[model samples]
Target: MSPSPSSRFRQQLIVAPAVLGLALVAACSNSSSSTGGGGGGSATLAGDCAEYQPYAGHSGTTVTMFASILSPESDSLQQSWAKFSSCTGIKISYEGSNDFESQLPVRVNGGQAPDLAIIPQPGLLAQMVKTGQVKKPDATTVANENKWSPVWKTYGSVDGVFYAAPMSANMKSLVWYSPSAFKKAGYQVPTTWADLMKLSDTIAKSGTNGSKPWCGGIGSGTATGWPATDWLEEVVLGGQGGDVYDQWVSHKIKFSDPQITGAMQTVANWMQNPAWVNGGFGDVKSIATTTFQDAGGPILTGKCWMLQQASFYEAQWPKGTKVGPDGDVYAFHLPAVNPAIPNPVEGGGEFVTAFSDRPEVRAVQDYLSTAAWADSRIKVPNATGWVSANQGVDKSLYTDPIDQLSAAELTDPTATFRFDASDMMPAAVGSGQEWKSLTAWFAEGQSIQQTARDIDSAWPQ
Candidate 1:
């Protein structure tokens, strides 16, 4: 699947202030009244970064940022930054690298840090805080964070201090399917895990031209096994409950712990069985070679019944693919595992941090955390994929129905939200061994116990 809409990146551009002002007026006219940080008020419009506009005289100033955003996401961000620059006169020099997690420390340790950085993994953010290279967020930024659920503050906090502000959020509890095919087969959407399995079994027994019940892939270049890790994390959220999942992510419990191993087993039961997955790719091992971006392709061709992925997967569909409840392709929440457990959401987003305490940089940081920035970001033509967890962002601002639905899911008070657990682990384990072991489990035929043991061994002291 495409990376979460909240992935961070940097770019530098300037827009005509007058044009931006007009855009802001138009957006404001179309905006909803859900003041994000401020109390109940109209949503912010582009160039409506009311609190930070005082820094407009800082036009010559530039804030450098480092992040993992690139390509299409970079294009969207640049479009958003142009307006911010025009409104505040502070330029942004953004740089996105795939190796951001590995390279950020080198830059900081070498005393070559940027003015700010958009960090995607809190574990890496914590590591930077330990080195004293990161600074605490300003009060205004803190207030913006507080406007959202306490979860945003918790994600950006370390040692009881909030240092980063939430930038973007993606929903991860979706199961993508072909609505037309389901209708043709007279199947209803499943509401619980048991129902989902029963539906899978029914699909398999129906002999729909010998197609598998599911399609999956874990390949992502060096990030190959990350998707499988997501599956296990989601299972843990429902199968074992959030508190235990939290302990596992903090490494308070070993990877070989029954709670974790059982989750992994749950994933294997679907992924390892030929009747359940790799519908178009032939066998389970093919999942290792099939790119995640193309993994859900079989759903359109009716070769696979479902593909569990995040809301961001909407962008990967071929052009003209319908994505609403009645569209050619659509998504539903992966059903709850237990009635007693509140619905759990597994997702990720970027966090904003600063290396410089200069007024201009601080102003830019404050603006980004507010509803104004979200409005400006969404107004950009290339940002159709964007979604904000900020309570202030209006549903009307989202052009895509899927984005709106995802945003609703993120802001749902009844749902439990947790960041991707692998991202919260030490880099050596989260991005390294977890990726390797999960890949080996499915592709190399490693036993579940051995896979769990291998990951546990890779954990740091």
Candidate 2:
């Protein structure tokens, strides 16, 4: 089966030219007496429904949701709701669309908005809050997010108020490879960025069937160059450290700043090398035309040894392809540049925000915030790419090794994690010039310095 629209659109998030800023409001705080876990709702609540028994009286109410989590993920989430529905009788009607970002405002403006929405971009969430399209999350929900890493709380907050809770997350700092091929070639996983480059040199020189060491593709139709953005983000997180990364995302640092241009040049150092990228596709420019969905294929065919991508890239592999340390395919964390910087995690996730504060909606939100819900989400099952950052979630529940590692990376307290920066910038820049400039830089032979300057110039005044 072809990838779901949700999977495809996951590469791109919508942006708008809103004048509002997140500084305008503060994040919401916990108000409920319940702890991070939803307090038991009913005195008679027992067994699987005990935690949610208190919500039994709210059964007649309905909770409607809008989001971009389509297909297998949506199916598993729906099945995971069995216990919550059984206990609360709150009927859930979720509508997943490829156009959620665009359609959301229309629904709100039309006064036909759902009770909740799974917002993918914090920037967009801030815009919605500014326009009064989103409601503050209740204390119970806030408490749950509070228990997670501060990054989750920060992403869900607009200004000082928290209005959303993290639902699902993925790790982007990964380099996929074939375990069998690596074993045959006597290659070991690199633990540091320097070691990774050294390994790349070895592979390129070994010339396994005259193949290259890396494969990459940035093509994504109108969203082309997003994967390229991921490369820049990963390198920036490593090269400049997280504090600078934060400033860069908020536009406190100009795109033309040395940090950015330096990072872009670092990307050019490898990607622009004819011996490093494009693998079976021929020249470096072919990376501009190769669909990201097809970029990993060369790794499987032994034409390339590695492809840098996010954990979700597991879905792009042919069905039933084995994935593990000993399986046909496996992925290792992209090693850190400076070990003292703490391993930087480049990833993204969905934030659950409410449009309505109805009791039923609150109950649904409360249940979702609980550990029971997080755990159940993985157990409900499908082809496993699902993982949770919830400290309460058990990594063993993830059947796929990729999902397990992704979760571990997210839950790693010492890890320096940052959301995708482009998704957090002003629409005119993030989805506009940043995408255009980077594409031209790689595909059209534009200078990295010129591309950085061009993108900096496009930042909204």
Candidate 3:
């Protein structure tokens, strides 16, 4: 089984920034803690600060950040830097708003942009760069980023200038199910798409006591259909591979193109198949109405057996619900569709982009890009549901079982990651028509061809 996604990470990856918050809660606390403040001299800090010497001496400087992450996750983010923040005496103030994407441009154009913002989409970051308001990363920050994979550097860059540091990442190609339920039903985890479908059929026919083999929800307030977009993106990515996936997102091929529509047809067969879905909920239309937050809950009561969601869905399970191979709920990778497709993992992440090039701000950005910070952030006390694309993160630091699972798959050398397509698409489509049209696919029984046409028409010509 695979690990988890933090909708919190997803919100940063997307909410609308969410469909990705479709991402989820982070991991739980269970790691070593030590203190060393002020040049490795005090016992008041959270972790080692030696690598941070060059960034120190900014006492009383406050670097401000703005993003879509809220509450506990936001709080954990603050703590992730507690040691660095303390060592440097640089206060990092944060502002989290549900309306960040809309308000950020307003903030930028008004000369009130944050020192840096955790931009969720490259598309949005590209817009910020176009305004000439967002600053390129400083040398130290860029140097730190150089240590990560070139793919991450590309996401943070526009054209070619590196602007943001890839932050928290979430894997969406995951299927959540109850371990005990599978054990009770005498089943094994499916590794290929054919077997996955077969397992669904096997469970559906074995008598679910009126429940089904799978359950799903596309609901997320205004982001209602974004979850469904994940369904199509994964099909395109896992079944078709990267070149085709890139062409689809860039509009080199239309959504109406068979390559794109073909994926949607796959979604229809799986999710829209009446017998396979709305497992714990009502009929097909209910998916459009059921909140993604509640989609995986039925797995606990044995009302449903499987839910396809990002790793972050771990945060949605009821408290006291154990989440391990031996626990009540656990997730496995969504599984490979074609043996020809090198492990394709569909995922998303936030980027640390700046409007201010102040030394303090860049210091923070540089820290986030470093392996030290990557490990630090994950070790934040009680933090849950987060994965960093940084290859530097120590797999062993992730003691939690789910974190171990997600980190393992994310770091798989053979896995090719395709960022969430809708999140990167032009907002008019990714967050607009594509969303509306996909919702219609479920709610109004819109045909895949028509749905594809509706979304294609919304593409900016």
Structural RMSD, model 3: 6.7
Model 2: runs farther than 4 Å from truth? 1-51, 58-62, 109-112, 208-210
What TM-score quantifies how close candidate 3 is to the native fold? 0.86
| RMSD of every prediction | 6.5, 8.4, 6.7
Evaluate model 2: give its lDDT: 0.75
Clashes of 2: 13
Model 1 spans with C-alpha error above 4 angstroms: 1-52, 207-210
* Per-residue C-alpha lDDT of model 2 across residues 1-461, encoded as one tens digit per residue: 01122224344343321112222112221223332222233224445456665455564456788876654456567777765664455667777765665677778888998898887677667767877878887877877775577868787888878888888787888999999999988999899889998998898888866599999987765556778888888899987889999899888988788888888877888778888877878788898888877899988888898998888778778877899999988999887666777888888777888998877788788778777788887886454666778887776677778998998888887888888887677655765587788889878999877888898888778
- Which ranges of candidate 3 are over 4 A from the true structure? 1-51
Least well predicted 10-residue stretch by lDDT in candidate 1: 9-18
lDDT of each: 0.75, 0.75, 0.75
What digit string (tens of lDDT, one per residue) describes model 1 on residues 1-461? 12332232212122212123335333223133342221213333333544443444454566788776665566577677665665454667777765566678889999999888888777777888988978887888888876677878887888778888988888888899988999999999999899998998888787467588889887765567778888888888877778898899888988888888877778888778767778877788988887777889999988898998887667678777877888998888887676567888877877889988887788778888988788878887735556888888776889777787788888887887788888788777887798798899888899999999999898888
